[model samples]
Target chain A: MTASSSLDGVLAPVLTPFGPDLSVDEARFIRLARTLMDQGLGLAPFGTTSEGNSLSVDEKIGLMDALAAAGLDMARMMPGTGCCALSDSVRLSAHAVTLGCGGVLMLPPFYYKNPSEDGLFAAFAETIERVGDARLRVFLYHFPQQSQVPITLSLIERLLKAYPGIVAGAKDSSGDFANMEAMCTHFPGFKVFAGTERLILSVMRAGGAGCISANANIHGAAMLDLVRRWQEPDAAKHQTALEGFRSVMEGLPLIAALKAVTARRTGEPEWRRVRPPLVQFPVEREEELMERLKGIGVLG
Target chain B: MTASSSLDGVLAPVLTPFGPDLSVDEARFIRLARTLMDQGLGLAPFGTTSEGNSLSVDEKIGLMDALAAAGLDMARMMPGTGCCALSDSVRLSAHAVTLGCGGVLMLPPFYYKNPSEDGLFAAFAETIERVGDARLRVFLYHFPQQSQVPITLSLIERLLKAYPGIVAGAKDSSGDFANMEAMCTHFPGFKVFAGTERLILSVMRAGGAGCISANANIHGAAMLDLVRRWQEPDAAKHQTALEGFRSVMEGLPLIAALKAVTARRTGEPEWRRVRPPLVQFPVEREEELMERLKGIGVLG
Candidate 1:
């Protein structure tokens, strides 16, 4: 099936909340996701900001089940399902499709470095074949910095040629506008989402899909404003404001900083909790960050 | 409990053979492990050479169970049990320990880059505590090139301090002898295995544990000879020969090249099958590699 038209627009790679015991705080997480949806943003959970790799498959499946049971519209969701193991990618992507989710963000098997393009194509091919679902619509997750595995254009072309409908689009988290432009330019119909909101205007003006960004967790309304006003004379002003807020989040470990901000805003201290290999933002840094946000009028 | 004395010597990061349908060939795997044991070398399955990350958790556990059922001595096995997910690593490691395996080669949670030492320490601490098995003995697997996560000397020190008996040693795959040297020098009683057989002599001479090399899958006898002769006067000569053979394997993708060599030796065409994101060595390159091996008197 073709990608859902609703898949486009300002989407937040939703931040995951954890309890004091470090288990995924499902209620807090759903509340945050619902808040984003209420603000007119699409939901892209389990992206880099969500500590997707740090979580187990069972945890992810359970979270999806929770979201579905909460009566959240699955059509607005595009969960990140890529993993180092093919089996994991299959398991996650199949679950999303079965849930009638809009699409799945598939990362190329990231464990092996410098794999042949043919090898990567084979991986995507295998996943699609194994899932064997007509409803499967894949938006390739291309975050080279984090995964160290680039989704090159040639590989994309090959996948598109082989599976025209299933290989729907990509999220260019390379943070390279030039690469995003290339994807938009080279393939006319392929959806290309800017990973960062900083280039939202440029991407939209260049005939590309909207952004799926980390900062959208806190700044979804501002980003949605930019998406709606890209053709307006004051668009650049909106872009500047979005970038300003994004820079604040980028100043620290992005995920931890986001959690810290959410904890302060919601008055839920458990929002500050992070799983291991990802320590919570230091207390002093959290205070400084809050002061800066307040100074910038992001916080009162 | 402390690490078993059986944890020493030339250990093969045993290669995994896949069936034509891309399924793990469990019987073939057990046969290879038995052959390595017969040749007086230890077994370290699911390592880089074994495509450990490519295999799913279920596949790895099944293979381990098959080996255990075949009456292979678990005391001589140290399977690589690291994954990007903490729960997956814990699961695999706990299974290995439950099977009475001697030790586990653990890779740090690798998906996140530039994590704080405290963060890494916390990851290891949680895994060790969660597994909570007195029989668990962890040998940290440090391969910066692959995992992009280095097991720093300081982190090692912290883990050792936190879990003395459980944190036994490390496998230094950084290919940086100085780092290996520092690990060997600073940690006197801790076992340190040279990742490559080239450093076997120096590692043994420096009071390190032994060598865990990919080439041992095909050339276990040669490596065992070098291990035994590291203290003899002709030790340097043996090291030189071992390096030469390793160089031949390193001339191409180490895993694919080794598989090609195995396919040629055993006349099992299925031995050439590799999972996605890792292609087979090209037929032309395979012929050339065989010619080179024969030239070096390594092939008949």
Candidate 2:
């Protein structure tokens, strides 16, 4: 099957757990990923919500190795393999493709802001040429808020013109539903992933693929169910519940709040430990956040 | 002597030369760096102008090794060692220290935009701790226009309070002379390096250390001269000339223009090659730019 066809549902831009020493807690990571997969969601490990940019190349490579060793089906995984360094991106993308990953989510070379379209195109072309893999499927990450580098439609057109099958699709984390809808409309077979599940129903109805979400780390089962039954008569109610839960989560720092919710579910405080440049969710607000989650029926 | 003491005067964020294959040409890089040193400037290799962020850690380490093997004095080279990944930053910083480099210029962990001050502190603190070397000196790089992650005065104060000796100084590249002046004014012993030669006189008068400049790639001897003769009667005229030169350079992509100028000066056309995400200077504009440079008395 084509990469786009295989990537047609909810996927967790998975939460990466760390030990007290801030090293990737491989066992915990594996367990959490397995649980998400069991909930019938795919994995986008090392995306922004996963604190992917905060991870060293060597650390990420080791984590991928661990995931493979655990016999997790690599075909269900589409890791975020982009970096500011072209060499690093090429290395990670090639490695991911080698491991039978469904695809790789690639951020633009983000360190330079407002780069020329020629430069941006050159960066992608350079990496693709260097990787030289026909099997590779790249999903462009357009998160202008975080990366400060907007992946414009013209650039997508240029990329698709250059590499038809290899260009694959996009993940729009910019929160511009119109842009997502435009991608779904513009590229007939393009896989368009909304960055969150809050827009999954509309996104799916737009002939978009599905969501690759931050909340999926906490609410994977519900979101996966929504993706499956999105056309059902009760789908509107389901989408509303997801939206309500997301609104409360949005009030807190995203990754931290997602981890806090996971910690609550599993009784494992260490799950709340984020790496440097990302502080832990505040203990002071934990009770209040949990109470609100319960008020919204997001918690049992 | 301390790491700070040895890092006075102008330092070129030296240009990186790429081959036809776009791999770094170590020989050309070393030759260019050696020439800059001979012109009485220190080196800030692997900096923004050098496409440091576009380079992998392995590539940087290899460049460092080549420099050492060529007998370039490590104590005169304060390479840019910071990365979005704390682990990569720590590794590069420690490596620079172990090589006996004078100081390491560091950008804050920049991937996540508007990170909490607490998180910024943790990223810096975590890297400093992991490197675990007292000899490691850090020169904070404040270029908000590029990184979009400002290194605020409050944040600097927190870092200095935590690690006084290790957090040596800063390079203010925000193009805000008032901020540079304020830094030099507030921090009694702190070394504040202006990001460009245009601010050198004012900054030096305000007790800033000399500049760490991209223009220094093409105009090292001139900037170094300005730093030495700022107290001379004719210094104001000298400063105006430098500013005029800078104005023209700013009109183009700074690094690409710098490289184009270098290519002209050295008669080595390959000097115009820039890595991806940074295209070469437009060939069509070369004559006009050169004529403008000549008009300003910056070119022969």
Give the best candidate by TM-score.
2
In the range A1-300, model 2's lDDT, one tens digit per residue, is 155467778889888889887888999999999999988889999999999999999989988988899998888888999899888999999999889888999999999888999999999998898999998999999999999999999999999989889989999999999999999998888899999888889898998888998988878788888888988999999999998988888867889988987898899999999987888888888888889888987766
Residues A132-181 of candidate 1: C-alpha lDDT, one tens digit per residue:
99889999999899889999999889988999888888999998999999
Cα displacement (angstroms), candidate 2, residue A103, comes to 0.3
Model 1 gets an lDDT of: 0.87
User: Which pairs clash (backbone N, Cα, C closer than 3 Å) in model 2?
Assistant: none
Worst 10 residues of 2 chain B by lDDT: B1-10
Error of 2 at A195 (Å): 0.6
Judged by DockQ cut-offs, the docking class of candidate 2 is high
Q: Write the per-residue lDDT of candidate 2 for residues B1-300, one digit (tens) a residue.
A: 144577889999999998888888999999999999999899999899999999999999989888889998888889999899888898899889888898999998898888999999998899899998999888999999999989989898898889988888999998899999888877777889999888999998999889999989877788889899989999988899898888888868988988888889889999999887889999888888989888887767
Q: Provide the TM-score, chain A, model 1.
A: 0.97
Write the residue-wise lDDT of candidate 1 on B17-93 in tens digits.
98866889999888889988999998999998999988888889999999999999998999988877777888999
Q: Candidate 1 — which residues are off by over 4 angstroms?
A: none
Task: Rate residue B30 of model 1 by lDDT.
Answer: 88
Q: Which prediction has the highest lDDT against the true structure? A: 2
lDDT of each: 0.87, 0.89
